[model samples]
Target chain A: MGLKEFCFKKSLWVFHLSAGSCNNCDIEILDLLTPRYDIERFGMKLVGSIRHADVLLVTGIVTNKTKSRVLEIYSQASKPVLVIAIGACPCTGGIFTSSYNFAGPLDKVIPVDAYIPGCPPKPEAMLAGVVKLLKSKNRE
Target chain B: MGKKTIVPIGPYHPLLEEPEFFKLYCDGEKVVDMEWETGYNHRGIEKICESKTFEQVFYVVERICGICSTSHPFAYANAVESIPGVEIPVRAKLIRSIVGELERVHSHLLWVGLAGHFLGYNTVFMWAWKYREPILDMFEIITGNRNSYAMFTIGGVRRDISEENADKLLKVLMDAKKKISLLTGAVMDDPVIHARLKGVAVLTAKDIHDFGAIGPTARASGVDIDIRRDDPYAAYEMVDWKVITAKEGDIFAKAEVRLMEMFESISIIKQCLELLKKENKGDIKVKVKEIPPGIGIGRAEAPRGEVFHFVKSDGSNSPVRHKIRAPSYNCITTFRRSCIGGTISDAAIATAAVDPCYCCTERMTQVYDIKTGKKMMNAAELIKLSQKKTEEIRAKGDKND
Candidate 1:
């Protein structure tokens, strides 16, 4: 593996972006950090700034109000940032698809490297999805 | 007056779990004014509910706040049931109360952990979240999901808590009570915590009344208003427990009220479980044929405060209009009262003290001009200021020893 790819695989700094979600998916994502799941063990951590992020973890069905902000953040992140949509909402618009504010199935808004689809996917599912995404990128 | 600086917190910031914007107009270190802009998280849940059938709306409303997931469903069920005046079975009432109380315990633990994190005390954050897992495990055993349980339905609940599950839940609760007691003692006795939180953001009883804050926010100020106790919905009246109130109305009182309320929630769940034993297992829901044209209002006490839902049915499969009033609507506004004149450091916890849920609070967003047009500090830096103060307090306490 190249040095750049090796470093990316070793430590992934994730920046969480909420694009008009119900907060269930957001809580599940936070749950991944707590003692039980402890994503930090794998050297993955949630960063406060998008500039330092290697993985852009987006939750919620991208709403009209947050659409521009989502795009702006995605553009601001350094290149090769893997975008992962973390709930049924962002993956397929979920139940709020018909709402006037609905602005996404996420992949249409930005390229999503992984999609973990649950109303709010379990923390176990989130961890597995991240690992799978990293492995696939390594193969590339 | 010192030169003013505008600190824009978010439409997307690390301190807030969801997107909402706050402009803190600070004069040097103390905040002189504050303005809020929401709607970033708004998916128009009420509008979405109008398109779904009465039965399907329960699932939609349950997502209003993941932290207080059951509270919205409980209120929505109460509203829909009241339209036909359909009384649910005893078992369902107990089950609903059980789910609500369990959500309260988990939500309060979540707030405590986040509060600790904001104050830069990662140990308290880790410990509180560690104890919270078993409660989530109990939720999974009973309702099948850790966050959104989806237990409530129109006339009653979607699932039944069997005898075996009840016994398991009881065992977990018994163990939880002891761990939480230890946590409570640590928080109450810590000199640093006392120095940080006590008298930080003092809100008077009149301020709570004027803002119409409900739940623990109001109770902390000795307002003595809880929807579950005042209105007495579901099995809240059937159970034996007292409302936890404190007269201080400071950040410490709010934390104290939430921590103590978890104990009452445990007691209520135990009583509900005992009552559930007397009822038949299958008698969980009452089948309602049709809805006559009518309007109904339902209110339930969420962990943060009261959740109010108004359902206007036109004798149709779906309600014509569904209006939701989450407690954060009233509680969030009180930031104007509590935050003003406090240092920017105290403002962080004061705003969070209400346990504000943006998903529950967002209904509309408006564009506003930033007159200063300068971003001095972000949410992370603001949180750092709060943590720095806590560190300073700890240092002083250690020197005293």
Candidate 2:
């Protein structure tokens, strides 16, 4: 692997973008930092700034209000950023698909490298999804 | 007068986990006024509930606030059931209380952890969350999902808590109670925590009454209002427990009320478990034929506060109209009263002290003036201001020693 790819695999700084979620997925994302799941063990940390993020972790269904913000954030992030959609909402709009404000099945809005599907995906499932995403990226 | 500066937090900020915007109108370091803009997380849940059948509405409401997922369903069920004049079985009521109380325990712990994190105390955040896992595990054992339990149904509950599961949950709750007590003692005795949080963001009972705030926020200010006790829904009336209240309506009092409420939640759960043992199993749900055309309102005490659900039915499977009023709707608004005159540093915790759930309350966005929008301060700077204040307090405390 190239030095850049090696570094990316070793430490993934993820920026969590809540695109209009019920806060379930967001809590699960926070759960990763807690002692039980502790994603930091894998050298993955949730960063505050999108510009510093290697992976843009998007949660919730994209509403009309958050759509432009999501687009702007995605564009602002440095290139080679992997976009992962967490929860059923972003992946396929979940139950809120028919809502008046519904504006996404996120892949249509922007590129998604991985989709972690659940009403709110379990922390274990999220960890596995990220690990698999990294392994796939290593292959490329 | 100091120059006015507008500090904007969210739509996408580190401090807020949800997508809502806040405009802090500051005169130098002190916040003179505040404005909030929501609608980013609005999924049109009430409108969507109209399209789904009564059975399906439960799941939709479950996602309204993932932290208090069961509370929405609890209130929705109460509303829908009242429309049909259907009374759920005793066993179901006990199970409902168990689920609701367990949610309260976890949700309050979540707020405590986040409050600690807001104050730059990561140790309290980690400790609070670590103890919260057992409650989540109990939820998984009872309702299948850790976050959205989906246990509530129109007339009863979807799942029955078995004898073995109740025993396991009881064991976990006992252990959790012990650990939480230890954590609570540490927080209550910590000089640094007291220095940072005590007397910060003080709100009065009149302020809570004016804002119509409920739950711990109102209770912290000595406003004796809890829907669970007032309206007495589910097993809240069935069990023996008292509402936790504090006279001082400040950030520290809010934390104290939430932490102590966890103990009450544990007690309620334990009592419900004992009650569940006496009740017969598999008598959880009742089959309802059709709803008579009528309007019914239901209210439940969520972790943060009261959750109200209004259902209008027309003798059909689906409700014609559904309106939900989450606690954060009223609780968050009180930021106007609590935050003003407080330093920009204290404003962060003051806003968060309500445990505002944006998904439950989002309805509109802020209108930005093009001229002044470019000079907005972000959430990171606000957090730094908060941490800097905490450090100053710590240094002051050290000097006093």
Q: Compare the candidates by lDDT and give the number of the best one.
A: 1
TM-score per candidate for chain A alone: 0.95, 0.95
Model 2 Cα lDDT, one tens digit per residue, B331-399: 888988889999999988889999998898864333344587645446677679789999999999999
- Fold similarity of candidate 1's chain A to the true chain A, as a TM-score: 0.95
Error of 1 at A14 (Å): 1.0
Local accuracy of candidate 1 as per-residue lDDT tens digits, A68-140: 8999999999987889999898999988889888986899999989999998899999999988988888887
RMSD of 1: 12.4
Off by over 4 Å in 2: A2-4, B363-401
TM-score per candidate, chains pooled: 0.93, 0.92
> lDDT at B371 for candidate 1?
80
**Sliding window of 10 residues with minimal summed lDDT for model 1 chain A:** A1-10
- Candidate 1 lDDT over B196-313, as tens digits, reads 9998889899999888888899999999988888899999889899989999999999999999999999999999999998885558988899978999999999998989999999
